[model samples]
Target chain A: MKILSKLRASIAVAAVLILSAVMFVDINDAQAEYGDVVINNYSDGAGMRPVVFPHWFHRVRFRCKVCHADLGFKFQAGGNEINMVKIIDGQFCGACHNGDIAWSVENCNLCHSGKPGTPTQVHESTVQKLAQPSGAKK
Target chain B: MPVSTFRAEFLDTVSGLARGAASPGLALFLWLLCVGAAWAGEWLPLANDGIHDPRSRAVKILQQPREALQGLTPDHAGNQVRWVQVLEKGEIRPREKLFPQTVVQKLDLDVILDAKGGMPAVRFPHRPHTEWLDCVNCHDGLFAKSVGQSKISMFKILQGEQCGVCHGAVAFPLTECARCHSIPRPGQSKPVIPAGIDPRIHQAIGQGQK
Candidate 1:
C-alpha cells in the first residue's frame, strides 16, 4: 500500500514539473520573436498599441543600406523619432510608405499590433539561456 | 505663352537653380513645393508634381537583384543573401554616401575573436563592413577603438547589443555559424596534445589566437 502511494506521489510531482516547463516555454514564446522591435515611444502616450516592428520582414525584402544609408535610420531601437506626422510628411517611414512602395499608413493594425503598455525596445528574451557562448549552435 | 507653358517654364527655372546650388537651393525648392501644395489646399488623385512615382524604382529593385546576385553563395538566414561575400566579390557597388560629396574612406582590419573550448574563433573582417558603413556607426558606441576593451558574449549579442545592433536584425541572422565562427580551434585531431599547450603551436595553428 505504501509503495503504491509513493508511486502516485512521484507521478504527480513529475506531471507538475512537466507542466511548469511547458508553461515557461509558452511564456517565452508569448514575449516576442527574434529581431522584433516594439516601438512604444509615443504609441502609448498617444493612446494606441505599441508598434511591433518586425525587422525580419523588412530585412528579407529590403537591404539594410536602403533604410540605414539612403533613409538615414540610425541602428538602434527607440532611436528614431518616428511619428505619424513625419511619416505622412514623407520623412522617415514615409519615404516608402506613401501608398506605393508596400502599403499606405492607413492600415493601422498591421504595424501597431503589440499589446497595450509594452515598452519600446528590441524583444530579446530576458532569460539568457546557457549564459555562456553558444555561438556554435545553429 | 499659354498658362500651362508658363508654369512649366517656371518649374524648369526653379529646378535648374536647385541643381546648380547646394542644400540651401534644394531646401528652397522643397519649401516652394510645400508652399504651392498649401496654396492648392486640396489633394490631386493623379498627382504629377506633389507625389513621387515608385513604378520604375520598384521594378528596378525587384528585377536587378536576380541578375546582380546571380552565381553568389546563398545564406541560410536573414536576407538569405551572403552580403559580405556579395560586397567582397564586388557584385554590387552601393554608394557609401547619400550626397556623394563627402568621400568615403575604406579601411581594412582583422578582428580575431579567440577560440572557445568547443567552437572556432570568429574572424571579423573590417574591409567589407567599412565599404558599406562609416566608422562612427559602430565605434565608441557598439565597439571600442581596440579589441579587449569591450566584453562581447553571446548573451549580450542575442539581446541585440554590441554586434547584435546589425547582425540578427538587418545584416544577417545568427543561424549562420560557420560564417563568423570560421577560425578553427587549435589541433582538431590531436596526437596526445599536452594540457598546457605550447604557445608556438598556437601561433602556428591558430595564427592570431596569441
Candidate 2:
C-alpha cells in the first residue's frame, strides 16, 4: 500500500512537470522563430558601422534589373567586390550619375557632403529661404 | 446479558469502521483520475500515430508548401489540389525536350532580384501531383539557378515556355487563373507590402506602358 501511494505521487509530479516544460518550449519557439533576421545583424555587425542603405528611398524609382542585372550587384553585400574608385568611374553609382538620371559630380554634396543629422539642416534652410521674401524686388 | 449478543454488536461496529477507511482510498482514486484526464487533454498525445510522431507530423505536413498553405482541411484528402498551374512537357507544339505531364512551377523572383521589391511569394502545390510524378518532371536540365534570366517569359508561356512547356496542354488548362491565383477572400493582401499604400505603387505606376 505504501509503494502504491508513492507511485501515484510520483506520477502526479511527473505530469505537472511535463506540462510546464511543453508550454515553456512552445513560447520560446514562437519568440525565436518570429525574431527578426535584420535585427540580429544590427548587433552582430555593429562594429562595421555599416553603410546606410535606405531601401524605400531608392527602390521607388529603380527596377531590380537596373542595379541587380545591369550594374551586376549581387543580392547580398560582400557577395560582389565593390570599390569606391570603380563607383567614381562609370561602374556602380556612376552608371546613372553621368548627368542623366540624377545630378552629376557637380552635386556631389547630395550624397558625400552632409554628415549624419546635417542633411535635415540643409533641407530646413532651403525651406526657410523659400518662405522668405527676396531682398531685391521682382 | 449473553456473550453472543455482545460479540455480534462488536462485529457490526468493525464493519462500520472498515467502510470509513475505504473513503480515503476512493479520494486517492479520484485524484489519480484527474491526473489521467489532464494527460489526455493535450492534443499531442492524441495526434501521435505509431509510424509518425507529432513533431514528425508537423515537419512532414510543413514540408509540402501546398499543405502548409491549404492547412489541414478535409478536402485535402481528395486527389485534386485546388490551386496550381500544372505543366506537362512535350505534349504540345514544341515537343522537343521532357515528357508528358511534367510539372513546371513558377517561383517568384521579386525578393531574389531586389531587396526593396519585397518577397513576391509563390503559391506552389506539389503534393497531390507529386503523388503521380517525380522530381525530374519539372526540373529537367534547367534544375536550379538564379531566376528571371532563365528565359521564361509571357511569350514563352504562350508558346508553352518554362511552366507553359507542360501546363498549357497536358496537366491542366491555362485559362484557369484561379487555379493558381485562387480567388482570395476580400481584403486579402499581397505578402510584400503592408496594408497601407505600397511605396512601390509609384514605381509600378511609372513602369505602366513604358
Candidate 3:
C-alpha cells in the first residue's frame, strides 16, 4: 500500500510537468504568428469587403520609411481613413498602386480577396531567399 | 476532481501543514516543487525595462533639466526652455522657433481639445513632437491623421496604447497631468509660429495634399 501511494504521487507530479510544457509551447507559437494585420475600418460599413494588407510582401521590397515617411501611410491598420476616392486621387495606396509603380488599383481582388491564400508559403520562401548570402545567390 | 476543487484542497492541505498539524518542511518542499515547475517554462519577464530604465543614459538627462536645455544652440534653446518653464513654473508661454527650417517646411499647429467633464482640455503641440520624430511615428500608428477618428481614452493611454507608448517610457512620465491638460490653467497663451514658414506645410499635414 505504501509503495502504491508513492507511485501515484510521482505520476501526478509528472502529469503536471507535461501539461505545463505543452501550454508554454502553444504560447510561443501564438507570439510567432502575430505579424498579420487586418484593415477593416470602412469596408464593412461601406458595404464592401475589408482589405488585408500583407506586411511580409511589401517589407521584402521597400523600407518602412518609403511608405510611412515619404508616402505618409499611418502605422496602425485603418488609421489612415483611406477610401476609394483617395486611392483614385493618388493619395495613400494610390501613390504606389497607380499602374506605373506597382499593381494597379484596378486589381481589387489582389487585396480584397480576404482568403488565406498562399501567404504562409510565400513568406517562408521569401525568408529563405533573403536568408541566403548576397553573392552566393548569383 | 475539477482543477479549482483540487487547487482549494491542495492549498488547505498546505495551510494545515504550515499551522503545525503536519510536517512544515514537507509542505514547504511541496510549494517549492509546484512553483519551480511553473518557473521552468519559457515565459515573458514580468517587468521589461526597455528604454525606460532609470539607470539608462537617456533618463539621466532629466536629472538636470536646465543644463540639458542649455546644451542646444541659442535659437533652439529658447524652444526647449518654454517646455522647462511649463514643467517648473507652470507657465504656458507661446512657443517660438518651433521647428528647424530644413527638416520640414510647415508652421506648427496646436490641437486644442475641449474640456471633458471637469478635466482641462488637452493641448497637443505639433512642433515639439515633430522635432524629435517624423510624421509617420504617430500618424496611422499611435494617432490617426484625421482628428476625432482615433478612439482615445484615459484607459487606453494607461495600457500603453496611444500616448502611453512614449509618455511613461522615454519622453516624460505621465504623472505630470497638467503638462498635457494645459487649457484651463491661468496665464495660458496661444503658441506663436515663427515667420517665413511655408503655408503649404500646414496644408500637407492637415489634408495630405501637396
Model 3: DockQ vs. true structure: 0.03
TM-score of 2: 0.23
lDDT (tens digit, per residue) of candidate 2 on B1-210: 122353345455555554565444444444444445444322221112111122322323222222222221111111122222111321112112122343433333222222222333334455534433334444444334445545444345544445553343223334332333332333644333336744532222121111
Ranking by lDDT, best first? 1, 3, 2
Across all models, the iRMS values in order are 22.0, 23.7, 17.6
Candidate 1 per-residue C-alpha lDDT over B1-210 given as tens digits, one digit per residue, 9 for 90 to 100 = 222354456577677776676444343544466345333322122112111122223222222223333344444333335666665666555545434465566679989988555667788888778766767677787889898888889778877688766776656555445566776666754222236744322223332121
**Which 10 residues in a row give candidate 3 chain B its minimum summed lDDT?**
B201-210
Which lDDT tens digits does candidate 3 get at residues A28-132? 111111123445666556554446554423533443445656667654445688888999898888877899867788776555533222121111111222233
The candidate maximizing DockQ is: 1
Q: Please give, for residues A1-138, the per-residue lDDT of candidate 2 as tens digits.
A: 997896677567656655655564322111111000111122123232222222212332443334544465543324444444665687866776667765664543233311122111111111122233566221
Candidate 2: pairs in clash:
B87-B166, B87-B167, B88-B102, B88-B166, B156-B161, B160-B164, B160-B165
Per-residue C-alpha lDDT of model 1 across residues A1-138, encoded as one tens digit per residue: 987786566556555554554454322223233455778899888877777675544543555556675677887778998999999998877887888876789877566656666666654322222232565220
**Which candidate gets the maximum TM-score versus the true structure?**
1
Could you tell me which residue pairs clash in candidate 3? A74-B140, A75-B140, A75-B141, A76-B140
Q: CAPRI verdict on model 1?
A: incorrect
| Candidate achieving the largest lDDT | 1
Q: Which docking category, incorrect, acceptable, medium or high, applies to candidate 2? A: incorrect
